[model samples]
Target: MPSAQSAARPAARSAAGVLGLAALTLLATAPRASAAEGWSLAPAGDGRPSFYAEGAPGTVLQDTVSVTNSGSHPVTVRLTGTGTGTGTGTGVPVTFAEPTVRVPARTRADVPFTMTVPAGAAPGDRSGTLLAKDADGRTATARIRLHVGGPALSALTVEHVAVHGDRITYDLVNRGTTVLVPKLAVRARGLFGRVLLDRAARTLPVRLAPGTRTGLSEPWPGRPALDAVDIRLTATAADGAHDTAGTEARFVPWGAVAGTAGALTAGAAVTVVRLRRRRAGRPAEPPPTDTYTDRDRDTDRDTDVELTGAVR
Candidate 1:
């Protein structure tokens, strides 16, 4: 039989082991117990994001925010904001009414945030914060800076399809972003509005001066004959590039007449010259004036009469 002292010692060691394990389990599940206990909101370095435009009451603008856990634990983030670059992007009762997102540890999550400015929201620079909260109710913040410009650029009008013979013309104005590098696929329509030209260029380098605009006038074949035409511009920029603004213009087919007329006259002149040269190449006719005509005529007649009689 074991002594009581030895028995007590074994039991004590077992109890100690169990208690130690229980403590470890508690530590593992407890919400971050320290000041450094929460997950951080890491941006994939999309330079400070913002959307600013002058909007009327009840304007809805949408934007996307990409987040990274960048920590050892999972993270949950909330979104709230108005569309324009300014004003209480976040509503007054301001809370991102979205279910919290669980960004996996060391992974990424692309969260979409929407902002609706109140009908009477004043214009200017309005700002807010996107809160990234952890399970522990701890948070990291990303500042949301927005601007309310004079107005949201709604429609674009690109006009003046000056046809220099077969070349098309363009004048791309970003009415919004500073400079937009766009892709150009020109579709030309006729009087019946049928597509006469449909072609795609991988990329057209567009550089527009801030607040001003850029213009291009290059002609392409298969342009439909219409009083005016519609040009659709699709532009894209990188992360650091400016906004994506699709624009169009109503242009007049004004100068195409001049080009067509000039082409015809030039063609006609070439034909006239060719005909004159052909006539000049034929054999020349001798002078019709009678140098020996009368005398030769009479002599030839008498000789013919005499020769006839001799033969008979």
Candidate 2:
């Protein structure tokens, strides 16, 4: 037998409790509704500002497409490509295996895809798209253009490397390619041991031939004690404005000189010892003694106990 007011109080509290529970449930699910996933695709322009490619019939189709992430959260991207079925192609050989690849906040990455047209591919002109996605399930795409002709007379090579006092020297080969000329640059850095070298802004002005190699010679001053590898040499070549080939050379340890010195000293010592043994037949020196020898007996005792003072 409860009073009316007391009963009312419990009912009110129950209603309030229900309302609170409902509010919490709404708050918990709200994020899913507002959260968004996306990425952006922009045209990848070569430094030269050209966006088209030229390939003739009976040529291999090869080109690169880059996709970047313009998002706040990481996303996954799977790359599938499409183009006019004129050329027999392995469309986009490399890509983000999904709708999105995880791109960290405020960072962009390049996705490279190679399209190889069969020898008989109908290759007057062809195009495709490379897609990039972030984990958020957003998408981005880059356009591709290609031209096929005679063997792309592009080349790449590395040479002229010298190791001087903890430094290395080298050259890059223009191992030929069909369409693009690789702009070349060189760099030197120390191992994980953070030692980055100051490189000059110099570019090779020659169009390296299909069989010719580029020469690289620079005095890269590095840190005092380069622990892991004194200097790391890297050569970058760009074909049609894309970095195509890169090579690295390591410095030789200067300790080799010390090793050479030690060996010479040891050899010289052995030679001297051998010479001394060969001269062993020479007369030997008499052994040293505090006591007089028989020949010097007189010095020890008078030749004859001289009759002192003639029988004084």
Candidate 3:
């Protein structure tokens, strides 16, 4: 038979072994509880990637954002909208039906929002992002694009045209509502109907935004030195935007021109004086003879003698 002390020792060892097994199980499951699955936030539709709305200025557009909790606990998020994409700023007006939303575990919450196009907003495409942020600072973004309804006019003009030595400078103004990548064609004609420069339409390096003006220049390295030239520039953009402007420039070597003019004036004066002297030194012609009979000849001699005596 075993001793009583040996029996007690085996019982104590069994209790310690059971306690260690319980500790191992708790350690394995604690991390899983603390770090649970996360949630997702996006547009509400089943197959939609983002939200897009179109309306005129001062119109209100509505959309929904879906917050889904895939973890085993509820999530709370604060929502906001900010302007994004091409011609919008971050301060666009956006209002949420529920700024703070609570999504239950393994479920989703759809929140509605309205975005109003400004009363003075120009006609074009604007965009923004719907932002959802949790207390833990985790963020999700849904994109939104809004197209303002109006007549899309593509108007542009080339202004302030000037020629500076070997370059042509001008300003491009976007008169209507839209962006423009302008194509420029330059033509020049000199005196005597001669074509000095002809350049085909080529795209410019700058982009013009709606209601914006940009200054630009075109190089004219091969300009003529002695002629009056008419420089014409035509600017065109997509959607039939067109404008043309012209400038006239005259180039001359003043010293050479002045010298030639002086020489011609001096030669003309000398020729005039020579012609006057020749006319003054010429002799007069004698009277013509007449056919007369002998009796007529005798009467003419007597009249001449009487006229001489009366004069004496």
Candidate 4:
């Protein structure tokens, strides 16, 4: 039999142990919840996932980004803009009003920013990111897409065309305000108007931005061994962009030609030597002699005397 006071002591100890276990569990879960509900960054207004802007070149576009601190502690973060996609330069020209912001617990900070379209920016879409980083090196990002407005012009040119052995090389230039994926066609004609090569137009594995140039080559595996060829390259892109360039190449068998030339030179030398020898070996001609001997003189005199008597 136990005393009531002792029984009450054991019950009180059990109750206190249960209470302590409950307290420990609560302490462990509280920190996890706080860490899980950490900070975030997003576009300022509405529920849009990213920021978007559109304007003409040499114009300034404005937008806002938000830094939120959902935990019980204050958060200080730094904001920056990183450029992506095909744009004028490496980074988007993002200028922030407050580059650094301090958000109170359960509060949000709105930061205003301006992105300037380059004066010579081509008409196309550019993208970037709005980034926020804290002292703990934790980072958050929000995307921004920008479109520049202008007349869409498509122009291209092929240049520096040349043939090297079994390959034809050329450069493609984008001269317009838009991006271009070019298609190439190759044609070659021999000296006698025969088509040596005719390759249909096919898509090239490159993208040409405005005012960009890229060098490319085409392979001609079974090229003519000896022929004078004219090679023409035509490049085309969307929106009526087109250009053509050409070059001439002559392939000669120099070794065979040299051998034939040497043989001909040797034959000419032999012929000249033979003619000289024939002339050198010929006998000399006899000296001229007067046939007017004493007999001849008497006959001429008698003829003259007869002629004179007849005349008389």
**Winning model by lDDT:** 4
Clash pairs, model 4 backbone: none
For 64-112, candidate 1 gives per-residue lDDT tens digits of 3445556676656554332223232333213332436666666665543
Residue 91 deviation, candidate 1, in Å?
A: 6.6
Per-residue accuracy of model 2 over 256-301 as CA lDDT, tens digit each:
7689888877876776666566668668757758775776876535
Cα-based TM-score, every candidate: 0.30, 0.28, 0.58, 0.72
Candidate lDDT (C-alpha), each: 0.46, 0.43, 0.72, 0.75
Candidate 3 residue spans exceeding 4 A from truth: 1-37, 45-47, 72-76, 86-93, 97-109, 120-124, 205-207, 250-312
Query: Which rank order by TM-score, best down to worst?
Result: 4, 3, 1, 2
lDDT of 3 at 191: 94
Residue 8 accuracy (lDDT) in model 4: 32
Better of 2 and 4 by TM-score: 4
Off by over 4 Å in 4: 1-37, 86-91, 264-312
Q: List where candidate 2 sits over 4 angstroms from the true fold.
A: 1-38, 43-51, 56-64, 86-100, 133-137, 150-312
Report the lDDT tens digits of candidate 3 across residue range 1-312: 221111232343355355431110111111111112387766654446666666677776665666777877778888888755475222346788788887767777767567787876667777677778888888877666676777677899999999987999999998887778999999999998799999999999987877889988999999987999999999999999999999999999899989998887777677656655765787864553575567877996997677545433
Best by TM-score: 4
Poorest 10 consecutive residues of model 3 by lDDT? Answer: 22-31
Clashes of each: 24, 43, 0, 0
Q: Tell me which of candidates 1 and 4 scores higher on lDDT.
A: 4
Off by over 4 Å in 1: 1-38, 42-45, 49-54, 77-97, 149-312
